[model samples]
Target: MKKISKVFFITLFLVVIAVALGVAFPEKFETITGNIKSFVATSFGWYYMLLLSALVILAIFFAVSPYGRIRLGKDHERPDFSTASWVAMLFSAGMGIGLVFYGAAEPLFHYMSNAPLAEEGSNKAFKQGLSYAYFHWGLHVWAMYGVTALSLAFFQFRKDEPGLISSTLKPLFGDKMNGPLGVLIDVLAVFATVFGVATSLGFGAVQINGGLSHLFGFDVGFTSQFIIISIVTILFLISAWSGLSKGIKYLSNANMVLAVILLIVVLVVGPTLLILNMFTETFGLYFQHIIQMSFRTAPLEGDNRGWLDSWTIFYWAWWISWAPFVGMFIARISRGRTIRQFITGVLILPTLIVSIWFAAFGTTAGNVQNSGVDLTQYATELVLFNMFDQLPLSIVLSIVAILLIGSFFITSADSATFVLGMQSTNGSLEPPNTVKVVWGIAQSAVALILLYVGGLAAIQNTIIIAALPFSFVMILMVIALFRALNKEIR
Candidate 1:
């Protein structure tokens, strides 16, 4: 305790207590978190949208301006990983399970209802649904990741500061970056990360278990979910111990390959032309309505505005919760790259892949519904597997999906622990193996506890509630990055 930072100990202590309370008193905890989630979304949703939009605009300005020429590290530094591997790691870590989880469900939910601003059950409504999918998983979210990475990378690699959230704020806080406020910032980051990662792991574990049940007629309950968490925890810990070069890098590379294989299989096996046409149509519709979507809010109709809070606002908060962990991991691997390159790589490629991914999977699912499949009968947890049933060899494909989510689960948790270890240890580039393992365990423990307590919704609502404060931290981060960049390049 003496050797370690206050940020690590205090954050971990608080997380354990919260998880213990949640486990010891599950119903009360769920009620409290659900209320908090609603309160935050109802009251401060504009903040989430405004800040996220600012990040998207900020990234674009930074990329197109002459400042784009600036490298994240030293002047002569070169990229650490090949482009393909780098993009792979970026998508695998940044989006993780959430992307695949929401691919179909989100769009279908939107399609089931008319947009507050669009016609229902018409072509406009269809476009609105697909557009909502792209919007939720679009450039704005990546802007959060890109800008955070830029600040941390620029400060740590170029300016020689500790690679912590507080370090990026030195331009504003000066010596206070090393003071109590700094500790608080790091503590908030750790707190949010713990719950955020757990929420994701909880989601993946439940979904994977559902797939297992669907594929092999196995039981789906706490027992199976706990085993999934335990297996993933151990696997990711070993990968975390193995470090970035061998375990994470190789897993990320393989993740991309597997993702592509599954994608091609889906495209070929599903409605190929429909998928392609949907991609083209949705991509255009999303862009045309991008400005409207970015600033969209409904204050008049109670139900209309309430809908936005549930879907759009919740998504914004979710991405903000995730940005820090993903930002740090991307920054760690993205040494020796230019600001333009890094921002574009972080922003464009993943968003494109997501667009294509949704088009392939989501379009197929929606088309199947149009053919009188009654997909709405399936529960949300079972929706993806049910979507696969529309194509050939669903059992085989379901197994592949389970494999994909399982690997993605391990890879995401592994990368997050690597970053968390660094944050807790004064942002060491090479955090100790022991520290990495412990952080890995803490992450898994939170996930397992949440799953045991109330399954997916409990963890989901809790993470959204946790992100409210951290969203402010990211807003500060954007300001800090702008100040740091202005000073460095000038």
Candidate 2:
């Protein structure tokens, strides 16, 4: 009891209380959260861009530096899982639900609405559509993950630091890291993780509910989403209770398998040649535009030029917000790997998977559009399922997609609860059951309330706002990581 971090506990308690109040007064909470999100966008959206660019630059330097030869653990230690299992866990941790959630919707949205200077529906817009999708989901997002994961893994395994985000920066501040500032970083991390996972769960519920409507004639509304999120919350709590090596691993591997199966089916049934071609072409174009896109921001052009905020900035913020949870989970499973190996696997493999997944699904969606099917009428959550509806064996495929999503939802939630427990319990690798269940319940409740109160679109707003502060923390992490690594090498 005495070892518990009072700062972590108090921060979580305040977060829970605020969320409870939000649930009690839905409109006011939405208004408050909305104002904050808007402020983050209007004021600091460019900061997210600049900060993300810096993080990516730093990650690339670390990967190619001589310091990359350093092992995450002792020289003799090796990875806990096989290569395949490790990659599966990485995908599950990084963005399993996100791929399924945005794979189809984003491409179409980008195709249709090019804001500010975008000539809407132009051939150029279509080109930008695929490029932007690849851009947002590509190396930079993974690099952000790489920054935090490498830092945490290096410090925890090599320096004997605790498995906390704050401790990763101990190199920058020395003993001051053990004081209030360190606690603040970890507290912000916990807060961001809670909302980040909750936002994902909330949007994922929209997908699940949308699937239910497409398959079974259920209506897509708050009640159905609430029930879906509740059932999902319970399953993940049970998984969290089962501990990491068992339930979480089994589900993640299973999800990777199922998700792969779905992608393969789409490739075979849909336009295989076009999908492959788009992937190749987009691969080049993605690299071509990667630099321009990284620093791409709207010129305070007009009232409607906020598209960058809605898409790119939103993505960067969301990815940063998820860095703490994803980074910690990756570090936990990533012991015994070299820094170079970790960065390559973390940055390259997942980016490849994302490209192939989007190529498979996005090509199919394009084919559907070519057949004169207008997909934009369906809700964003329903977009992927709608595209699946037109494919052969739609029912079976949609069911599989939903199950994959549910598995993702479970893995993300369970891992988050585990991380939350660890963060609150003085960085214990194995947190208490009480802490896990409490966090599990609180996470579920926040998702449900956000859904019933603000609907699907509201999900990312809170996360974008929560992620803003953590963006700075992540930069500090990268700086601190390099300083420590350089010292070790010298």
Leading candidate by lDDT: 1
Ten-residue stretch with the least lDDT total in model 2: 114-123
Clashes of each: 0, 0
RMSD (Å) per prediction: 1.6, 1.7
**Pairs in steric clash, model 1:** none
Residue runs of model 2 more than 4 Å from their true location after superposition: 1-3, 115-118, 300-304
Cα lDDT tens digits for candidate 2, 181-238: 8888888999888888888898788898889888899987888887898899889989
Error of 1 at 398 (Å): 0.9
- Predicted candidate 1 versus true structure: per-residue lDDT over 382-459, tens digit per residue: 888998987898888888888889889999999988888888989888788887888888888898888877787787
- Candidate 1 residue 221 C-alpha distance from true site, Å: 1.6
How high is the lDDT of residue 437 in model 1?
85
lDDT of each: 0.85, 0.84
